[model samples]
Target: MAKLKEKKALMIIAERNFRDEELLEPKKILEDREIKVTIASTSLQNSRGMLGATVKPDLLLSSVKVQDYDVIIFVGGGGASQYWNDPLAHSIAQKAVQKDKILGAICIAPVTLANAGVLSGKKATVFSSEISKLEAKGAIYTGKPVQVEGKIITGEGPQSAEQFGEAIVKVLENLPE
Candidate 1:
């Protein structure tokens, strides 16, 4: 077997409130494999999760340069809507795709990618409430527990958090060194 290259992932969470499991589960999976994970948000302060998990961001989103990581994941919650039309979030998503980096989004977080124009013609899944929004952005809605199209992965909601993380790890593991 070939040795896997060291991998790093950037996880973006809403500054105020994000879904706890959606961020934690995937982060744990990546770390378990020795993949470095950096938590980032709009601010450097502690961001609170819906279920009370407080995470201090390692970096501000504005400081992120797409070339620094192999994967970029956007964690979702009601607060994730804050990035739906955010230009910085959109720019980051666009740059991730341009760099062929793995992109992951769960729940409504996919909306941010959609608005970034990266989801067009890609098969994706999102929380039910944002299905039409995703479709409107030209994404083919799969409605699956987890959807992986190319390097982009999307999950429906909190219930699929574990599966979502596993999917990301699987994709990362398969990448060429």
Candidate 2:
């Protein structure tokens, strides 16, 4: 018998205008299952969501050590586009793939992963407005609400946030500790 490693998830949100459901739904799901969930943002200030929800991030995105979590999710909203061209965010996304961790993105946040080059050659989904962005990065865009390719999980939009979280949990549970 051995002690199973506790799972941890890191969710990155924009400093402002992150989709409320995309971050909250998945966080509740993971925490309900006793998995640790941490929040990171472009800054340490409280982040406000598009629909008026507010969240206080636990850490600065630049300080994240990707290896600390079993999963890393990029939560989407219009502000998420900030990360789409960010080298720091790109590096984090790339490192997650290199480490074989479960990487997730919801709504337009998938564009960040797509821009990072991690979604290249992977089947993924994103908000309809950003489907072309994913395709431009070599991702096969699946028009589904949620699509998982290997360890990469992508959700179409707020409507699929819960399913996206469930998908991440499924992959996390099935992986070697």
Candidate 3:
């Protein structure tokens, strides 16, 4: 059998509150670039949004080890208000950064980065509602569609999801061999 082409793996983690466009749009863009995007959640089964939209997770966050992914992305939602506070999620986020993997988060999901202790002293952009909170975590807040500081990238909200996705593609494309 011919060897399958190896593709970069992107891990998108979100709770049921993940905004539809925020997560799905990025996934689509990554897929278009032939990058493997996996949707992981607190559980292995499907997770539903506040609007009752159901999304199946490719893997369970609890079972995921950050070393296996090339990038780790967190999606925002009102649901993130709760999810970000989960200890396990913070652990995974911290692990990703410690492993030097690219970390991306949109909207309120940046809260995960803040909570993970990675945003300290880094410039980041996040949902308007959480700008103050992000600042409190020692992140320099900005009002931009996307901000890429080193291996970390952050977007404001669902409105910037498409650009957020594109930013990730460019970052990945330009990575050193």
Clashing pairs in 3: none
Off by over 4 Å in 1: 1-5
lDDT of 2 by residue, 1-177 (tens): 211247889999999999999999999999988888999997888899999998999999989999998899999988999999999999999999999888999999999998999988889999998888999999999899999898999999999999999998888877764
Backbone clashes in each candidate structure, one number apiece?
0, 0, 0
Tens digit of per-residue lDDT, candidate 3, span 1-177: 211124455555455667888888888888886677778887767777655667888887778878877778888888777656788888888887889888999989998889888899999999998998889899999788899998899999988999998887777777666
Candidates in order have lDDT scores of 0.93, 0.91, 0.81
Q: How do the predictions measure up, each by TM-score? A: 0.97, 0.96, 0.91
* Candidate 1 TM-score, C-alpha based: 0.97
Clashing pairs in 1: none
Which ranges in model 3 have alpha carbons more than 4 Å from their true place? 1-5, 50-52
Cα RMSD of all models vs. native, in order, equals 1.2, 1.8, 3.3
- Using TM-score as the measure, which candidate wins? 1
lDDT of 3 at 170: 76
Q: Which candidate order results from sorting by TM-score in descending order?
A: 1, 2, 3
Model 2: how far residue 88 lies from native, Å: 0.4
**Stretches of model 2 off by over 4 angstroms after superposition:** 1-5
